[model samples]
Target chain A: MKCPQEFVFAANYLADMARSRSLEFFRGEIGAEVKADTSLVTIADRSVETMMRDAIREWFPDHGIVGEEFPVHNPDAEYQWVLDPIDGTYRFAAGHPQFGTLIALARHRKPILGVIDIPAMDERWSGAHGWPTVHIRQGRRSEVRTRSCTAVKDATVFFCSGIMWRNDPMAVWNGMHGVNRLLDGDSYSYGLLSSGFADVIVDSGMKPWDFMPIVPIIEGAGGRVTDWQGMPLTLDSGIEVVALGDPALLDDVLRRVSAA
Target chain B: MKCPQEFVFAANYLADMARSRSLEFFRGEIGAEVKADTSLVTIADRSVETMMRDAIREWFPDHGIVGEEFPVHNPDAEYQWVLDPIDGTYRFAAGHPQFGTLIALARHRKPILGVIDIPAMDERWSGAHGWPTVHIRQGRRSEVRTRSCTAVKDATVFFCSGIMWRNDPMAVWNGMHGVNRLLDGDSYSYGLLSSGFADVIVDSGMKPWDFMPIVPIIEGAGGRVTDWQGMPLTLDSGIEVVALGDPALLDDVLRRVSAA
Candidate 1:
């Protein structure tokens, strides 16, 4: 499935809208209200989600929505927008500037456009189905592609967070125990993967909004983002997402992290 | 022993000099020459270290020097300077902007003044005996303090990188394997701890220049920094370091990471 150029344009527009709203809360005293899951929610999250949802309603009323805050709107529409207004709220509430606003357009449950906008960092990574992935930082833009490194020992692997790893029932913690070059990071790690700086990224317990935008970015950058079983990511995909800059290392990475 | 106020002033001044020199290389195509230890070395590292050493020679000709890139100067002097021109060269070479220049003043083999200067981020953390720790970013400065959080479950722990945990002969990492709210970061993590935004930073295989500057900053902020064995950090301390915001958690934290 392919997204129209206008879809990518609209997704970035919606992302910019989210960016302006989220920027005001970064490094400031933004209060957080604990959500039902014991995760965090700040005004920036609610405000950005509401603003994006309204924009989608006005521009693409026929499209459905899946977001981290609030509800699912128009669940049966053929095209849908997936959003995670603040991707790393735990860090955001602590005034750390790595949190981001993610936007993606999916057709029939498959993402065709994705945008990861980090307002504080002034960086954005966006991709559409048939075009090269683009990374923008500090007003400069360049096409990006993942590198090809096959050996697991030479590969720099990353986990999403120590918090997620600590509670791993999937035993990924044990699976990755001895990987010498591993790192622990977040959406930023996925950004690095798409840009050839980092070779592999793995994480679990993510939502459709948490993992969808990254699918197009990495895939268009000539990498892979799949579940533990190597299935393509969709709204219905499992919580675990593994991204590799070098497609050749999938078997080696999978052999280690897929089973524990 | 207390260092004269001039020593702290000179340290920050030296850091600024190093910062101005290093800023030009950040995110640019700085050349790297691998060291015999298989770690990275960049022109930024050599240039900044040379500049700092020259400045120290001009200002305190009798002081000793120990730097990452060059040999000791004035080794028999009563006071010495420790410098790590670029502490995170691997990230710097990858165009990741978390690298920084560290400056510390040691008198009688103990650090009395320390500064961590992150040029690209435009952030700096500095501390001297008899004063509060300071964090500077975006042209604003604030006296920072570490918060007290006693329970391991309630604490927010951070690691310098997952790479350190991947090859843990000391096993402090296994002790921290399952605590909640862990962040993957570096010197920035220590700055956050000094600012009361985080607690509990653990890393091993550090050098004098790599770990010394952080000692005064955290201790001046009313926290603690020591080797994993719970010994106060000194020129002779082991490479493993554990920092905690609340002294109450020391026993609990030490029980796990302090031993193999």
Candidate 2:
């Protein structure tokens, strides 16, 4: 199934914006302004989101927009674009090179395309529904897929500590007993999971913008991404989610976490 | 008090040998050999450890040698040299460029000096007891310090998955929740905490070589490195450890995890 041309074009354009932002950030001229929540924000986040939102308005005026820095542009539209201008802002602010800009396109309440651009790291990942995922590194593009490691004992779990688990924590903890390790970061964890470095990623307390872009990227890489209850992720959902290279492991994790 | 001249010379020579090994593994000519545990153990691990161990035997005959690859020599000596030939072996094998060689000196059952060398990444970190910690990035040396973020809520927490936390999942999981985010890899995470980019790193199930080099490095950077109960990190404990910028936060984390 071919994705709409606009999705491809917009994703590429966003990647270009990320490159420029990364260059500016490393040049050490701009300061990171603190938001009320004490998390750092920068001019790049605002500028990139503005550029992306403007392009969406011009090319798909009927589509909606939801971003970390901005309110909804058209909350009722069937087609929407979600943007996390800088997903690893803390890492970025601290001069670490693990941050990325995330974007995803949804059609009729489902994500059809996604992009994660880490310009400083010189890596880019893009995918659309039903199409093979692609990674661009050092000006070369290659297909991407998650590894199908079956046993929890062999699995490397990527996790972030900020979110609370409503469940008992014992089952998830027990299931984790089988894991090799757990990493953190919301979308970046998905990036690594899709790249075959990790098998499972569990996260909680996500907004639509935080998760929508990651679903297609992992799904396109031959993995399953769903809410904690094992429900498929949708553009409207704001729930806990787990992405896994194998579907059976996802079930195992869910059973363990639910039991906990 | 100034560190002994012999200790500095020995560490520098070992660091040089470690660099050569890292270069070989990263350059990819020899290729990595997988260990029985499924982790990669390349020729670099063997070659570097051999070079360092040989030097210690010839130059410091009375000292014990505890390393990643070889059996301990003179294990009952008053001074021991601990080694991790290549700390992030997985990253080195996969060409991730974040791996480092770890070397530590312990006298009278306590770490006296530590050195972490990552030749591929062009970074070096070293410290001696009562001496200033130093970070050399791209060949420039700067004094390193722990980050000033004192509260657990305000602190950035890092963990190396459930590998270290397997013994007490609830304690580890709950301790993880006490920090801001969870990052991985004992070698690199400890380096980041010492450099002030992160605060509060905890690891369980660590080997002597894995945890020894990190103790002096973090403590010399004005942070505390101790077992989960806030005691000092001695050699080969294979127990849980916590490294924090503030003593109060460390106590809080230990209390939370112990209760869990």
Candidate 3:
């Protein structure tokens, strides 16, 4: 399904608004509170999501909204917007610039457009169905694509926090041996993969608002996003996610992780 | 021991030159090759070191020069400059902006001045003996001090990489439980600790060029830098290093890691 350019434009505008709102509270004294799920939430997260929600409502009254910091709205609508106003809240609260705003437009539960905006770094990546993934950094824009890697052993893999995989830490730890692995890129890891700099990313304990926005960006960049069992990610997909810059290494990676 | 203002000025000048040289190859087609020790090295690393070394030789010919990409120069001199032309080479080669240039001036084997320059991020952090640590970002300069976190369990810790701790991975991993731990910040992690954003850092397999530069920066910021055994880091300290924003937490952290 091709995503209409109008939806893509709207997503970018929403992301721009989110970036502005989030930056206002960045590096300041934020009153961060622990959410019910044990995750951190700051005023920036709530403010950005609220701002984006208002704009989405004003522009597309019937469209649904699913956000990290807010309850779902218009859940039965045919078009839905998924937002994670601030993806890496811990990093943001710690004054790291890698945290980003994630935006995705889903049609009938399928994400057709996605945006990853890193405001502090002045970098933004956007992708839509049937359109090339584009990255804009410091006012320069360029199309991006994933590179090809045929084997798991040769892949440069990124895994978000080992503690996130508490249920099966050793499985990932043992499986990722012999591969060039780096820990903790969070959402930015997917952006690196989409730009052909990282080969694979294995992350767990992600929510819909966290994983939905990257699906189109990775797919449009010629990569693959799936569960550890090699199933496509959807609005209701499980938390254990694996992304591959080169789709050919999926089976090898799956086998390695499962056998561990 | 007070660091001479001239040495600090020279260190910053070297860091500035290194940053410019490294940025030229960043995100470009870098021909990265594996060193004999299995670490990756690129033209940017060698080029930056060469530029810095040349400047150092011309300005202070009697001073010793030790760099990651080259052999020691004037090793017997009282004033020695330690340089890691490009720290976090893996991230740099992957087009990630977290890589940085580290420069430190040591007198009688004690690091008296240090600088961490992240070219892509346009951020620089510098410190000297008896001087407050300062951070410069996009031309804004401010003195930085480490925040107070007195307990190991409550500390925000940054570890370099798990694979580097192949000797005792479980010791560090099990010890870090219940803390806000992040993996892979390299030299930038110490900068964050100095800026009061991070509280602790545990790393292993560090060379002199990697660890020497951070000692003064952390010390000047009201933090402590030492080996895992709590001994002060010297020119010949062991590869295992630990940094704490609050000196009060050292015993707790050492006990935790040792007990693990």
How do the predictions measure up, each by TM-score? 0.85, 0.78, 0.93
Best by DockQ: 3
lDDT of each structure? 0.78, 0.72, 0.82
Q: What DockQ does each listed candidate score?
A: 0.28, 0.20, 0.40
Q: What is the per-residue lDDT of model 2 for residues B1-260, given as tens digits with 9 covering 90 to 100? A: 45576796779778977787568656353332221124345466787788888888899999999987878889899889998888776545444556788898888767888898877667788888878888887667888877666567767776665443365554565656644554454676687778777677767767777778887788889888888776787785646778776556777778865666
- Please, what are the lDDT tens digits per residue for candidate 3 over residues B1-260? 78888888888888887887788777765422221112334567788888898899999999999888778998889989998988887777777888899998888888888998999999999999988899999999999888888677777777778334565565676688888766655888789888888788888888888888899999999999988899987677878888888899899888776775
- Tens digits of per-residue lDDT, candidate 2, A153-257, equal 766676554343544443454557745544454666677677666677777778777788888888899999888788888876866888887777876778755
Q: Compose the digit string of candidate 1's lDDT tens values, residues A1-260.
A: 56698888898888888888887766554332221112334567898999999999999989999998888998888998998999887667655677789898889998888999988788999998997899998889999988777776666667665324344422665566544344455787788778877777878778899789998999999999888788899988977778898899888778877565
DockQ comparison, 1 vs 2, better candidate: 1
Q: lDDT of candidate 2?
A: 0.72
lDDT of 1 by residue, B1-260 (tens): 56688988898888888888877765443322121112334466798899999999999888999999898888778898999998877666555667788888888888888999888778899998887899998799999888768687777777665334445422544566555444455777788778877778777668899788998999999999887678887777766788888778888888876455
For model 1, report DockQ.
0.28
Better of 1 and 3 by DockQ: 3
Q: List runs of model 3 lying over 4 Å from the truth.
A: A29-40, A162-164, A167-170, B30-40, B162-164, B167-170
